[model samples]
Structure formats: C-alpha cells, structure tokens
Target: MAWVYLFLGGVFEVGFTTCLRFTDGFRNIPWTIAFGICIVLSMVFLEVATRNSIPLGTGYAIWTGIGALGTVAIGMMFFGEAATFVRIFFVLGLVACIAGLKLTSGH
Candidate 1:
C-alpha cells in the first residue's frame, strides 16, 4: 500500500511539474492553483509512504526519480522540447537508476 501511495505521489509530481510550465510565474491563476494543489497532494502521499516504513532515502530518491523522468517526457511530448539521442540515452539511464533503487530497497 505504501508503494501505491508512493507511485501516486510520483504521478502527481509529474502533473504538478507539467502544470508549473503553464503557470507563467504564478501569474496564471488557474494553472497556479492546480500546481499548488498537486504539490500539496504529492507531499501528502510521499509523507504517507515514508510513514509506512519505507526507508527515507529510498523513498525520496524514487520520488525525485519519478519526477525527473516524467518531466522529461512531458517536455518532449507537450512542450516541443527536443528529444535528441543523447537526451533519450540519459533518460533511459535515469530509468535504470530508478529501477535499481526500487529493487535494492528491500522494501
């Protein structure tokens, strides 16, 4: 269940990050509100997962991993960011690290 919470938090992390791009430095009220809500919700879920006996370091690494991976993809797909070969390679490396962290965590 903690894993569920953790993953949900990651999903929300991606959402908030995507919304952040649209916020225009908090001048866009709707996107800013969405970003604010998602940030709070993401933190709540992360805190819950940590409380469930997930190692703090492991949980935080995974959370930020998910955020990073998701943000890169969003940048490519939605924001016209270049998806160069080098970028793809690094993103895949990030995936490997995230997976390795999960497997080694002994959760």
Candidate 2:
C-alpha cells in the first residue's frame, strides 16, 4: 500500500513537471493551476508513503527516479526531445537502481 502511494506520487510528480512546461512561466493560468494540483497531490502521496514504511532517503530517491525517467520519456515522445543512446543507457541504469532499492527495502 505504501509502495502504491509512492508510485502514485511519482506519477503525479511527472504530471506536475509536464504541466510546468506548459505553464509559460506561470503566465498560463490553466496549466499553472494543473501544475499546482499535481504538485500538491504528489507531495501528499509522498508524505503518506514515507510516513508508512519506506525510509525517507530511499523514498526520496525512488520518487525522483520515477519523475526523471517519466519526464525524459514524455519529453522524447511528446516534446521532440532527443532520445540518444547514452541517455537511454543511463535511464535503464536508473531503472535498475530503483529496482535494486525496492528489492532491498524489505517492505
């Protein structure tokens, strides 16, 4: 359950970051509002997950890992960002690291 919340929080982190890109530096009211909602939800979920069982350090690393990976994928797929081989390699490595953390978490 805590892992679920953490994953949801990570997804919301992606949402907030994507919305941030559309916000036009907070000048776009709709996207700005969306960003605000996502960020709030993300934080709430993170707080819940961390308070439950996951350690703060591991939880934070996982959160940011998910956010970074999702954002990069979103950028490449939707925003025409480059998907270079090295970038992909590092992303895969990050995935392994995240998985390692989860497997060792003893949750």
Candidate 3:
C-alpha cells in the first residue's frame, strides 16, 4: 500500500514536471493550475508513503528516480529532445538502479 502511494506520487511528480514545461512562466493559467494540482498531490502521496514506515533515503531515491525517468521520456517523446544512444544507456541504467533499490529495500 505504501509502495502504491509512493508510485502514485512518483507519477504525479512526472505530471507536475510535464505541466511545468507548458506553463509559460505561469502566464498560462490552465497549465499552471494543473501543475499546482499535480505538485500538491505528489507531495501528499509522498508524505503518506514516508509516514507509513518507508525508509526515508530509499523512498526519496525511488521517488526522484521515477520523476527523472518519466520526465526524460516525456521530453524525448513530446518535446523533441534528443534520444541519443548514450542518453538511452543512462536512462536504462537509472531504471535498473531504481529496480535494484526496490528489490533490496526489504519492504
């Protein structure tokens, strides 16, 4: 359950970041509001997960890992960001590390 919360939080982290790119420096009211909502939800879920006995360090690492991975994928897919081989290599490495953390976390 805690892990589920953490995963949802991570997904919302991605939501907030992706919305941030569309915010137009907060001038775009709709996107800005969406960003705000996502960020709040992300924090709420993260706090819940952490308070449920997830190790602080492990939870934070996984949360940020999920955010980073999702954001990069969004950038490449929607924003025309480069998807070079080295870039993909590191992304896969990050995925592997996130999985490793989950597998070894003893949760």
Candidate 2 colliding pairs: none
Residues 26-100 of candidate 1 have per-residue lDDT tens digits of 999999999999999999989999996789899999999898999999999988999999999999999999899
RMSD of 3: 0.8
lDDT score, residue 34, model 1? 98
Candidate 3 lDDT, 35-102, residue by residue in tens? 99999999998899989668878889999999999999999999999999999999999999999999
Lowest-lDDT window of 10 residues in candidate 3? 50-59
RMSD of each: 0.9, 0.6, 0.8
TM-score of 2: 0.97
TM-score of each: 0.95, 0.97, 0.96
Query: Candidate 2, 73: how far from true, in Å?
Result: 0.4
lDDT of 2 by residue, 19-74 (tens): 99999989999999999999999999999999969998899999999999999999
When 2 and 3 are scored with lDDT, the better candidate is 2
lDDT of 2: 0.96
For model 3, state the Cα shift of residue 3 in Å. 0.9
Candidate 2 C-alpha error for residue 37, in Å: 0.3
